[model samples]
Target: MSTIKAVRGTRDLLPPETELWNRVEGVARKVFERYGFGEIRTPLFETTELFVRGVGEETDVVSKEMYTWEDRARAASEKAQSLTLRPENTAGVVRAYIEHKMDAAGGLRKLFYIGPQFRRERPQRGRYRQFWQIGAEVLGPVSSGAESAVRDAEVLEMLASLLDELGVKGWRLEVNSVGSSTDRPRYVAALRAALEPVKDQMCEDNRRRAETNPLRVLDSKAPEDQEIINGLPKIADYLDEASKEHFAQVLKALDACGVAYHVNPRLVRGLDYYTRTTFEFTVPDGSGLGTQNALLGGGRYDGLSEMLGGPKAPGIGFAIGEDRLILILQEQAAEQAESKMDAYIAPVGVEQNAAALALARELRRDGLRVEVGDGSFRLKKSFEAADKVAKAVVILGEDEVASGNLKVKRFATGEQRDVSRTELGAYLHGDQ
Candidate 1:
C-alpha cells in the first residue's frame, strides 16, 4: 500500500525550524501587546458574501484565488450556503468588529492575530495554498481617533519596531496615499482615460484591470509593463487637499520617530478599500524571496466598516507573511544557538533506572531541562547520546544514589566534578 503524503502546497513545520516560528510569534505578542493590542482568533472560513461585500468582487483575492464551496444544509427546509476559506483576514476581522458591535465599547479595538489563512493560488517560494499571517487591526468609531494620521503613523512605527526586534535587516518602507473614497473616483477616471490610450500595449492582466479596476493597473509587476505603468497618472497628483494633508502628517510622524520611508506614487496596493494611506515594507534582493519581497502591506481603510454593513469605523492594519519572514531569517543565517538540554542523566546500570528517572524529575521541577538515558545502554553509548543534546552528563549509580553524590562531566571542556545532590542544580546552571 502506498503511504499518504502531505497535500500539495502544504508541509509540516518540524522542530528547530518551529523554534524560529515560536520566536517570531513570541516577539510579535510582546511588541503588539506593548502597543495596547490584544490577540484575537477568528474562524478560518466565513460566509462567502462576507468577503464579496467587504473585499470587493473585483479584487483578485475574491474573484480568482478564494477556496470556496457550497456547505450543504442538514435539513430539507434548510438551504445550502457558500462558504470560503479566507483569502485575506482584514475582511473577516471587520466582519467580527461589525457583528460584535465593538463600536459600542467606545474605544479603539486594537486586535492582533496569528493564524493560517487559505488561498488556492499557485504556490511558489514563500507563497503557499495554506499559509500563515501575523496581522493586527485597529478600528473604532470616528470619535476614537481611529482615523487620525497619528494612528497611521503609530501603526507604521510599531511595524518598524517589530521588524527591527525580529532582526529583519535592510527593509524599506514605501508609503503612498491612494486618496479617499471621494478622491479615488476622480483618480480612477483619470487612470481610465490614460489607460484607454495605452491599454493595448500593456499585458493582458493590466488591460483587463484597466477596465474592471483601473487602480490595480498601477500595481502591475510585469517587467514589460513597467514603462507604461510609470507613465500612468500618479495618485499623488489627484489627491484632494485633505488626503494630501493626511499623508503629509503620516510622513511627518514617521520622520519624527526616525522611521524612514520613500514616497512611491504608484503604490496603490491590491485592495479596493484602501483610502488615503497605503504602505508596504519590503526587503532587498537576496532575502530568499525572489521578486515577491514584501514583508507586509496595509493601508488606511476608513470606510471598511460601512462597506461590511456596519457603522462608520475607520481603521488601519497590516499582515506579515510569516512563511516569507522565516525564509528571510533563514537566509540571513542568524546565529540561533540550539537550546541545550541542561543535564542528561545517564544510568550506570539497569538497577539504577528508577533512581536516574527520579533525579531527572527533581532537576526538571527546578526549572532545568533534563533528559534521562536508558539504564540498559552501555556507558559509552550513554555518553555519546548525551554529548549530542546536553551541556553536561550526570552519572547515576547505586553507590551515588545512596551517597547523594554524583559525577558530572561538562561537554565543553571535558571537565568532571563530584557534585552533591543539593548542588547539582546550581552546578548544571554554570556555577561550576
Candidate 2:
C-alpha cells in the first residue's frame, strides 16, 4: 500500500488563507457587478477542438500545455471524442455564446466567472497545474457596440478599479495594438524578411519561432536574444489607418478617464483572430517570480467568433491569475486578521453542561459569536482554551445557574465581574 498525498504541482489551501480568498472573491463580485457584468460559468472541460481553434493552434498553450484525453466510447455505435480540461476560459465562453444564440438577443453579454483551470505545465511559485482564475468577457454583434473603442476603454477602466478595490498598489498597465486581419499579413511578411539575415544568431526557441510564428519571437524574454529581438520590425509600423485610429481612440479614452499606460511596440498576440487593442497589468513590487508579474492580460478578438464557426460577434475580455493576485495581496498585508468570537462558555462541572449550552444558544441567537466548552474540562484548562478563541469566558456553575447570575472574565482587561443572566447577552456583546 502507498500513502496518498496531493499530486505534484498541486497544493491545498487551508484555513485563514482560504478566508483571504473569500474576501478577494467578494470584492471581485462587488466590483464586477458595479460594471453591470453578470456571472457565467462554463464547464471545466470542453471538446479539445474548441481551444485548438479558439486559442491559436500555433501558440504554446495549445501545442504544449493542455491536458487532453480521448473520451471512452460507451458503445460501438458511439465515437470516442477528444476532450480537454480547459486551459483557458475565453474559448468556452465564446462556444456558449454560439450554442446559446446569445447574439440573437441583440445586446451585449457581459459575463464574469471565477473557477479552476487545468494545464500540464510544471508548476512553480504562483504557477499550478490546476489553478483558479477570475475573468470577464463582453461580446455582442457590431450593432451592440462591440466594435467601438469606448468598449475597450471601459473594460480597461473596470480592471483598474477592481485592483484598487482589492487594495493592490503600484501596478502598471501595458497597452498595444496587434493590427487587424487586413494589416497583419504585411507585417508578417516584413518580419519574415528581416529575420532571414539574423536568424542564425538567435536562440533555439527564437529560431523555431521565426520559422513558424514570427510574432511569437517578440514574446521571448531570453536575456541573450534581447538585442536581436529588439531590432525586429515593430508591429506599430504595420497598423493600417483604421487600426491606428482605433488604437488612438482607445488611448484617448484612457487619457480622458485618468488611467496611465505605456505603449509597447513589441507587444503582440499571434492569433489571427486577435485584433486592434491588447493590454497587460503588472506589478513591480518584487512579489512574484521576476518579470512574470503579469496579474492579468486581455485584448480585442474581432474575428474569434468566425474562427470558431460562429457569427461575427466581436468581444474583449481579461483573465486574472487568481493565485498570482492572491500572492501579491498576501505580500501586501501578510495575513488579514479576522475577528474572533465575543465569548466562550465554560461549564465549571459536568452537572452544569445543559446550562452552558442554554447560555451559548442565547448569546448566539442574539447575533454574538459564542463558543461552548466541554463540561469535563477543568477550570484552568477551560480558561486556557477560552483565552485563545474568545475575548471573554462565561463560567456557568451550579451556583450561577441557581442564582441566575454568572462570572465573566475579560481577557484583555483582566477584569472579573458578576452579571445577571438577564443582561448577559448585552454584556458579552458590549464594547469595552
Candidate 3:
C-alpha cells in the first residue's frame, strides 16, 4: 500500500498556521467593510469558457496553468461538459454578477470574497498549486479614468492598511498601468520587436512567451531573462494619450492619499485581462519571501465582463494570496511575539458538561473567544490543554456548579478566583 500525501505544490494549513489565516481574514473583512464592500461567494468550478474568455486565451493562466477537465459523470446522460477549478476569481465573479443581474442593481457594486483557487504549475516557495486569495471587485459606475484610478487607489490603500493593522511591516507597493485594450496591441508589437534580437538568449519559457505573451517575457525570473528585459522597450513610453492620462490620474490618487508607490514599467500581471492600473505589494528590500516574494498583486480588468459574454461592464479588483501573507506573518511572529488567546473552558465532570457548554457559549456571546475542552479528559489534563490554548481557564467542576459559581484561573498569573455564574459573564466582559 502507498502512503497518502498532499500533492506537490499544495499545503495543509494546520492549526497553528490556521490562526494566522483567521487573523488575516478578520482584518480583510473589517477593512473591506470600511470601504463599503459586501461579501460575495461564487462556485469553485465554472464552465471552461469562463477562463478562456475572461482571463484571456493568450495568457499563461488560460493557456498553460488552468486545471481543466470534462464532467465524467454527466457524459453518460448528456454531452460531456468541460469545467475548470477556477484559477482565478474575477471571471467567476463576473459570471455571477451577470447571472444575478447585479449590473442592473445600479451604483458601483463593491464585493469581496476569500477562498481557494487552483492552478497547475511548477510551484516553489511562496507559490502553490492550490492557493487562497482575499479578493475585492468593483463594478459599474467606475466611469472616468480619474474615478477608475481613485477606486484603484482606495482598494490598494485598504489592502495596505490591512497589512499594517495585522503588524506586517517592511512591505512596499509597486504600481503601473497596462493601458486600455486599444493601446495594448501597439505596445505588444513594440515589445515583440524589441525582444526579437535577444529572444535566443532568454529562457526557454520566456522565449515562448515572447511570441505568445510579449509582456510576460518581462516577467521572467531568470537572470539572463532579466538582462534582456532590462534593455527591452518600456510600455509606459508606448502608452497612447488616453492611457497616459489614465496612468497619471491613478498616480495622482495614490499621492493624494499619501500612499507611497513606485512605477514599475516591467510589472505586467500574469493574466491577460488586466488593463489600466496594475499594482503589486512586495518587501522593500526587493527580496519578499524568496525569489518570488510578491505578497499581493492585482490590476484593473475592464474587458473581463464583456469577455464573459456579459454587458460591457468595466471592473477593477485585486487578490492577495493567503499563503504568502501567512508566510510574512510567520516572519513577523519570529521577530516579535505571537498573539495570545482570550479564554478556554474545561468541564471537570461529565455531569458538568452542560454547565461548561453554557458558560462557554455565554463567554463567546459576550464577544470573548472561548475554547471548550471535550469532557472525555481528566480535569487536570483538561486544565493543561486549556493552559496551552488560552490566557485564562474557566473550570466548571461539580462543586462550582452545585454552588452556582465558577472557578476561573488566570493562566499567565497563576491566580484563581471563584465567581457566581451571574457575575462571571460581566467579569469576562470587563463590566465588573
Top candidate by TM-score:
1
Q: How many backbone clashes does candidate 1 have?
A: 0
Residues 191-281, candidate 1, lDDT per residue (tens digit)? 9999998999988999889988888888778999999888888888888899999999999999999999999998898677889889999
Please rank every candidate by lDDT, starting with the best. Answer: 1, 2, 3
Question: Which portions of model 3 miss their true places by more than 4 Å?
Answer: 72-78, 141-147, 284-288, 334-339, 344-366, 370-387, 392-432
Q: What overall lDDT, based on C-alpha atoms, would model 1 receive against the true structure?
A: 0.91
TM-score per candidate: 0.87, 0.84, 0.82
List lDDT for all candidates, in order. 0.91, 0.89, 0.81
lDDT-wise, the better of 2 and 3 is: 2
Off by over 4 Å in 1: 338-356, 371-432
RMSD of 2: 3.9
Please write out the lDDT profile of model 2 over residues 1-432, one tens digit for every residue: 999999998889986578679888999999999999999999999999999888878777888899999999999999999999999999999999999999998999999999999988878889999999999999999999999999999999999998988888788999999888888888989999999999889999889888888988887888998998888889898889999999999999999999999998887866555788999898984876477778888899999999999999999998999999989888766434233578999998898888898888988899988899998999999999999878889999889999998999989889999989989888987843
**lDDT agreement of model 3 with the native:** 0.81
Q: How far is candidate 1 from the true structure (C-alpha RMSD, Å)?
A: 3.1
